[model samples]
Target: MLLQVEPMIPALRRYARALLRDTSAADDLVQDCLERVITYWNSRRNNDDTRSWVFAILHNLAMTALRKYAGTQGMHVAIDDVAESQMVARATQEDALHYRDLMSALDALPAEQRSVLLLVSVEDMSYADVARVLDIPIGTVMSRLSRAREKLLRITAAGVPAAAPMSVLRRVK
Candidate 1:
């Protein structure tokens, strides 16, 4: 099973890191998941949906962690943690300067939209699968995906709404 499951580690890590934003926390969660799988491979052997099972575990763990962190810290998980990778994919160094800007745009998104976008774009999960994973209807998954696309497009297009005047002036006091 190790041979079969070993290849999933990277993808799992990427999804977990995206979800948690904190590398150490993500790593710990993934380790815990691996431990769970190893310890319970016997019962899971009868299940054919290994991919879904793994993601379900990771997603549930992240939610639990999020809840505990929220209760203790009274803080939100910054979307920047998830958007940092998107910021890195820009075409030039100039684009890199706007990492926080991109993050802010993503931060404005509702959690539902963000989760759908992540499942579809990052995890490459199908609409039906994402629906099941999120415990929502398939139509809801599609709707969220559509809205997320609209928001992301508007967000990443160019100058910020409030900065348009300053951007056009190209002058600093």
Candidate 2:
């Protein structure tokens, strides 16, 4: 089980980081998720997909944390302050700008839509899996994904920075 779960850590971290927008907090969340997975491993149905079950645990934990912190202000860190070594690769100037714009657009989306988008597009989860993870109907998953994509296209096409203000960050919770 540990060996099976080891390969999922990177994807879990990425999803957590995208959801929380804070590296340390995301790492903490992933840790908590893994702990819960280990504790409850035997309780899971034999036929259930482990990936979806793990993601569901993570999503539930993120939602709980977001709610817990909704009314409080936390320390804010600028992206430029992050160490260069932490980046996966050196991006060209154009790629960096494009990636920034894309992330900003993603951040502008409602949490529901963004969650659906990331799970489907970035994590490569099937709609059925995403629906299971999110406890939403498959049709709802498809609709939210469609809306997220359309919104992203419109934001990128406008060539305007869509990053929400820091004061509004908690609204995504």
Candidate 1 lDDT over residue span 1-173, tens digit each: 79867888887798778777667688899998888878877787464467767776777887888777875653365776566776567667666557656656666678778878888998898887787677789999999999998988886785573223333546668
Best candidate per TM-score, number? 2
lDDT of each: 0.76, 0.92
- Please, what are the lDDT tens digits per residue for candidate 2 over residues 1-173? 99878899999999999898888899999999999999999999999999999999999999998889889888777878778787656879999898888889998899999999999999999999999999999999999999999999999898887884435335543
Stretches off by above 4 angstroms in model 2 are 76-96, 164-173
> Per-residue error at 69 for model 2, in Å?
2.0
Instruction: Report how far residue 44 has shifted in candidate 1, in Å.
Output: 3.5
